[model samples]
Target chain A: MSTFRADLHIHSCLSPCGELSASPRAIARSARERGLHLIALTDHNSARNAPAFAAACRSEGLAAVFGIEITTREEVHALTLFPTVKTALEAGDEAYERLESEPFDPGFFGDQVWVDENEEIEGMLDKLCILCATDLSLDDLGPWCRSRGGILIPAHIDRPAFGVLGQLGFLPEGPFEAVECTEPLSEDLTDPWPVIASSDAHRPEDIGCRCLEFEAPEADFEALVMALESGKTRALYGNK
Target chain B: MTIKELQTDMNCRAVWNGWEDREVTGAYTSDLLSDVMARSEEGQVLITIQAHKNTVAVAVLKDLSGIITASNRPVPDDMIETARDEEIPVFVTDNNQYETGWRLHELGGF
Candidate 1:
């Protein structure tokens, strides 16, 4: 049978938009309920929760991929997925420096809260937890992700925000292995790239509701990346 | 017109007063929660019609300059109260999502 059940993009409470229910344990429990085999907690710019999230996923017999959704200098968005939590953390450090900037008090956004697997409320994050880095460019991000044994996918190419097309009007010369889409597209599109669709879920209800099905030896980050890079995947949206 | 002028011209009320001086760097328009979370930048403003609380969460995670709810849609009371608490700017526009985004892009010079 094809390895079909996985969600490559999800956010924890660490992300400003993530639901309070988006704790690592909460996500894991929800994934289990939804029958997802793999899930990634890719908070915006910060992977501070990855270690804890990964640990929780393991306890639940769910495979977890540590990742961060980084905003490049050009304002394009990319998903950097790592094989190990250590690599994801190290990449977070690099992202912190590259994406870090003075906290903007839009006077409408509240302070970000970090939570553990137990769904317990943790302390507030200082230094603007959301603003992780401003230094990493699209070119630099690719090598960092690769060196750390991670895969980088340009996020939501069809959308008008932070998309490679929306920001730069075209894909950068190199550094991206695939493009993520929120909706389906024709395979013959001229982008000359493979496409992956994810829910990019921020709420538990959203997890595994949409995913990519691929033929692989195993259901792990490495196998998923290889399938995506080789263009051997199909978008699958859960009917439930 | 600059964002400053547009804000005034459109009677755009600044929810977060501190953001007035920051130049309107650019605008990002989206409704899908995950797409916005994965892509938005620190200072860019987000324009969408989705008025759920999760919209605020995504906006905060991305460190968005502000959020504009389009099509003259009313910002939910709970979301407004939350936005007030978070210090993130939230507003409603008479134009639909596409038109509001286009107008913001034209005015912001994007």
Candidate 2:
């Protein structure tokens, strides 16, 4: 087995808050240029860009994980990673069904663009992707993601905004596989689950700023899951 | 002004009055808990739309006078329970944060 550098909390242009330059092609190229072997496309509340990200990663010769940065009803952010593009889209559908139907305003909330692997704008998401899932609570997210062969990791637990510990006062008992922190892991947040770090990049240049080094036979979704379960992961911080 | 006086004068509904009415020297308004924790001082009531358990936790940490959830935001039962257990009274106001802040400003005490 070999260690692979992975940034698992990247946002595509599909996220309402993401920069327009952060297209799937641009993200894949940037990750590759940064010497990252594994990456994930995690847009806010939707995985509509997963298919394009898959194609982009293929052209860049990088292994990709498909997921979404889900905003739960409690306004807590969690990274939900699936084994394939299909499952990621399915999870996105579940989150979409729980959101309030608010129209997307480009001028105010920024554009939610859908770009293909060729760096072409195909269309735009109709509803605001940043809206919190008003019906899906934090407790329900774990079981929902797990039932569909996905893993849920509370994103940026140390952040005071849009974090599980920040929004819910404390982390409640849930089936969390791991937790993500942008900063160095604090003793106050030491829990049974392993702690991971990601850049949570919303722009191309920020890719791989923070990542994880994990030993896996191959930089694939299943191998990554196995690595996490076996505790063969190291949280790598700083720009590379 | 005291928390009880603020609630009565502003016509705010007392959702959870677990603590004794105490003086409110000032008030801070922000939905971001980190901002509230950093900028707010003790004896200040927090006026925000964030009606969650974490808001109560921040109030306890900062020793705020009380919490006044503005804009008719719904306070979950769990948050109310936490406030009660922490001995921090929570009030709900129909007015938004801007209106609530101005009203408190007009009250001259805080």
Candidate 3:
């Protein structure tokens, strides 16, 4: 088995907060340049860009995990990864349907532009604010993800804002596959679950700033899942 | 005024009644908990739309007198439970943060 570098949480231009230059192709190129063997497209609440990201990653000889950074009812951020693009898009649909139909002001919340694999603008979801929380609670999400052949991890548990520990005060007992922390693993975090770190990158340059290093035969979704399941993943922080 | 008195005056519904009545010396209105942690002083009641348990954690950290979840934001059971544990009263008001802050100012809670 070889140690593979994986960044499982990255936002595409589809995320309103993500920079306009953070397109799927550009993100894939950046990941390749940064020596990322495995990457995931985890735009906030939507995986519409996963198809483009997958194609981009395939062209760049990188493994891609389709994911969504879901904001739950409690306003907690959870990262959900799917084994396939179809499943990711299906999960995305559920999250999209659950979003409140608030009129989105692009100038205020920024644009939600969907782009193709070729980096061409496809369309924009202008009616709903992707940044807002979905009706799904973290409890609801744990089973929701697993049953769909996906995994759910509370994103950035170390951060005090929009994190599971921050929003809920403590991590509720759930079927969490792993927990994502932005910082290096420390004894202060007493959770028994496997811990991994991701850049949660909003721009191309931030794409592999923090990553997961795990022993896997190949840099594929199944191997990554196995690594996480068995608590064999290591968080690489700051040039480590 | 005491938290109970402020609740009554501001037409707020108590989600969690604390162990002891604490005086509301002032009020700070902001949804950003980080801002509250930095700027909100002791004996001040925090007026915000942040209705999660983290807000309660922030209240405890900053030694705030109470938490008023403005705009009638839904208070989760966990948040109330935390407030009860920390002896921090949690109240919900139909008014937004601005209106709640204005009402609190009129009541000399500033």
RMSD for each of the candidates: 7.9, 11.1, 10.7
- What would the per-residue lDDT of candidate 2 be over residues A1-240, giving only the tens digit for each residue? 998999999998888778988999999999999999999889988888988999999999999999989877677889999989999988887786666544533564477887776778887877666633446788988889999999999999887668888777787887798899888866567477888899899999999999999999999989988999999999988866
Query: Model 3's CAPRI class?
Result: incorrect
For candidate 3 chain A, the 10 contiguous residues with the lowest summed lDDT are A100-109
Model 2 residue runs over 4 Å out of place are: B1-110
DockQ of 1: 0.09
Residues A57-87, model 3: lDDT tens digits: 9999999999999878777889999989999
lDDT of 3 at A103: 48
Under CAPRI classification, how is model 2 graded?
incorrect
Docking quality band of candidate 1, CAPRI definitions: incorrect
Error of 2 at B70 (Å): 9.7
Q: Which candidate is the best by DockQ?
A: 1
Ranking by TM-score: 3, 2, 1
- For A1-240, candidate 1 gives per-residue lDDT tens digits of 367577888888777667766788888888888877888878888788887798789988987889889977666678889888888878876676555455544333444566665656665444444423355788987887888788888888776656777667667767567778877765553267777777888888888877877778887887887787777887775535
lDDT of 1 at A99: 56
Q: Which 10-residue window in model 1 chain A sums to the lowest lDDT?
A: A124-133
